[model samples]
Target: MVRRMFLPFYSKDRGPPRIRMQVMGTKGRRFYKIVAANQRDPRDGKHMEVLGSYVPIPGSSASSVAELRLRFSRVKFWLAANASMSLSISRLLGSAGLIPLPPPLFGWRCRGRYHELLQQQQQQHLLRESELRNFFKLPSPISTQLVERETEKPKKEDVRKIVR
Candidate 1:
């Protein structure tokens, strides 16, 4: 008699697969592998395939840069295959212009290229404000407010009211 081993087959009912990060490396120093995995699988568990890698924290040297290496073609393929992404993975891909950014979460600080873009926008806003003020011949609000404050003295009644 001959015996053969059979592998379990995954079915559609298990839900769509996910493209997410699989944590690796030692304590206090960690790296991630971007992978395609089943949605129901535990984090850092078995994965279908690795798409890329990410190094969030680089070495202590000033010249060191955070690294994020991805195979864009493979990533696109998995996305087209209906793979969802974890929140952090989605943010990373969004920064690369792979897809629209996910909705902002409370208390999340913008970093990297996103922060630079925000700074550029703020500078543009200030420039536009100055241009509008100049075109309208409006008095500088700071100077006018200072002059008004120096000219007006708080009455004794106001002080008394506050003291009461």
Candidate 2:
């Protein structure tokens, strides 16, 4: 008997099964399609089935709540079939009590360090903005009223100084 080697992404018969929420829709609005697909498949590629859909942004409705539409029976069937979920899908499932909250990520992936870095970057960006504002003798970008007033009233002296 000969053993055949198969690639997980392309191999229909091997490896752990995965189901993911595939992002779709246009620029202003976006949504997701819950799909049973190979992990290696392209974002909009082949899907075995569409379990359901989720609309992150509401479509011109007065209600503020986000919409989540699911074929409950299909979801139950897929869960019984042992399909694993993507991170985002898992979170939704967790909130619905369909599954226990997923395990916490390792220490390195924790938010503290990432947040520190983000804060540092934002401070640097703000510093740059302030520097630019000072150099141009213009109101800081943070205040919309200041920006509007500054734009409406021309700084003739400042313009002359820059030209000189």
Candidate 3:
């Protein structure tokens, strides 16, 4: 008789495989392992393979630029394999340029609201300017000229003369 190792077989009904981080390390000092796992599994539970690691806080003596290290080839393979990535993992991958960033919350609705707010601000600014002009009893042309003069940048020749 021959002994053989068999991999755990998960059915489609169990849910799609997921790529996520598994928290490790002690309190205060934290470490994370990027892994390919089953969606039904617990956060730090059994995983199929480790894709890479993320160290949020490196050791004091370490001089490396980035704290995160990933195997891009393996990650790409898993992504192509139809594995769904967790939100946090997706954001990290997106920042690394491996994947497109998720759509902004509320999308076009936010842009429309921002434009409305900008219009309201402009209206308020105009109203305030008109009130200031009335209160100071300044002519429109004079006020406009004064604003232009204040906004104009001094020429290099003028700056040199001032410096001298």
Candidate 4:
């Protein structure tokens, strides 16, 4: 039997896209990832707006760029919409003569990511370590004794007759 519908619980939304970015960075290094939000929502009309975006050009090599002059006006458009660049992205932009290098954002945001990653790593490590400890306790482990080798005299017959 179908349950009675509640208008408050089921509301259809026809609106703009929801998008955001997930960035990983340290004081001097930053990596960025873009994610589209609300795409999975049934009420979403189309692909959601980007939460964040990044310029993925490898920062180390300038010669890799094919053109001597290029425009990143599209990326700038996203920036104008309040999108932020990853540290690596900022560095790349600076190297490409786009924008000035940004200072380290070492407030709660930077620390918060570090703290979350650290906690996750610690939990994973503990889980693996416990699994290993449990696995070693299984049956069929053979015991062995440790002892030093005893010296033995060489037999004359076994030695070389030439004496060289």
Candidate 5:
């Protein structure tokens, strides 16, 4: 069985080139590649496999417009193996009806990506809260002032009065 690997901060530091569809070639020529590689590897480094190819600029007149040289079967296999495509690739495939539009990053994988995103969001929220606290000299979120009076324990005398 193929093990599912989760590299935390892989997308953050190295970016999503490996698991993503990349646009290659110089200015005059451009092509797309669906590949899977290690995050730390170079752009042209070792890849698991070349799932498919998309030639956006087919310079040759002999070739039909928008020629897509793809291994349709391999595409499905890679996707099943937990590989994800870039936004552009998703859009391209969506247009071709191969895959759905607005494809998600880290599709159908475990909660690793989601947890990372949540941590990032939480950090940002904490940072914003700290900034607000510093500016306003307000107490921490867990402070007494922030606690609801209704939820607080009633004093013994108050409880006795209620009982009476």
Candidate 6:
């Protein structure tokens, strides 16, 4: 079946790459991204690698449903198998004749069924952090001045000579 996959982002010291949704390509047990047909093949589509990210140009765009549908035959085998698609990659699917094209996706939304689970996980993380803080018993972050208060009374000086 189609197991939807998310295209996570990666960043380096020099630059960063955009998110790319990928899935096990039907061609030959390879992982490839749903890319524009106009672009070069990512490879033989054998190994799991990015084909390319779907880039939407500003103002006007180049990719169209027609261009995408032309490549549908290549992807039909996978679609029949119900190969999973990523949330961000829906446009490609629509273009390729799987689902109807919708608005551009800025990010991926995991199977909505897990929203409660995600919330629980976040709450658990917060609780663990609080527990750690309480266990450590660390003082406040701000520094305070230490003042010395003298309370002991001074002894009276002996006026009489010592009887040695």
Show where candidate 6 strays beyond 4 Å: 1-53, 58-70, 102-164
Q: List the residue pairs that clash in candidate 1.
A: none
lDDT of 5 by residue, 1-164 (tens): 34445333235655433455566888878776767665665666556677677776456642233766667787666566555555665666665657755533667236566776567557766777787888888876623222335677889999999999
Model 3, stretches more than 4 Å misplaced? Answer: 1-14, 57-66, 106-164
lDDT of 2 by residue, 1-164 (tens): 21222232344454444668888998778878888776667778878778878776456642222766677777776676566777778866764557765655568348576666457557766877788788989864755221333356658998898899
- Which segments of candidate 5 are over 4 A away from where they belong? 1-18, 22-26, 58-65, 103-164
Q: After superposition, how far is residue 79 of candidate 3 from its true place, in Å?
A: 0.5
Q: Per-residue lDDT of 1-164 in model 3, one digit per residue for the tens?
A: 21122123333655556899999999877889999888888889888889999876455632232567899998997787677887778867875669975543476447776676457556766777888888989777223321334578889999999999
- Per-residue lDDT tens digits for candidate 1, residues 31-109, read 8999988877788888888999988765574223388889999898777776778788887887666887676644434
Off by over 4 Å in 4: 1-71, 103-164
Distance (Å) between predicted and true CA of 74, model 6? 2.2
lDDT of 1 at 106: 42
User: Who wins the TM-score comparison?
Assistant: 1
Lowest-lDDT window of 10 residues in candidate 5? Answer: 1-10
Lowest lDDT block of 10, candidate 4: 1-10
Candidate 6 Cα lDDT to native: 0.43
Instruction: Name the top lDDT candidate.
Output: 3
Error of 2 at 90 (Å): 0.7
Which 10 successive residues of model 3 have the least lDDT summed? 1-10
Q: Could you estimate the TM-score for every candidate?
A: 0.54, 0.48, 0.52, 0.25, 0.42, 0.26
List all candidate RMSDs to the true structure. 14.2, 18.6, 22.5, 21.9, 19.2, 22.7
- Relative to the unseen true structure, what is the C-alpha lDDT of residue 23 in candidate 1, on a scale of 0 to 100? 88
Ranking by lDDT: 3, 1, 2, 5, 4, 6
Candidates 4 and 6 compared: the better one by lDDT is 4
Q: Provide the clashing-pair count of each candidate structure.
A: 0, 0, 0, 4, 0, 6
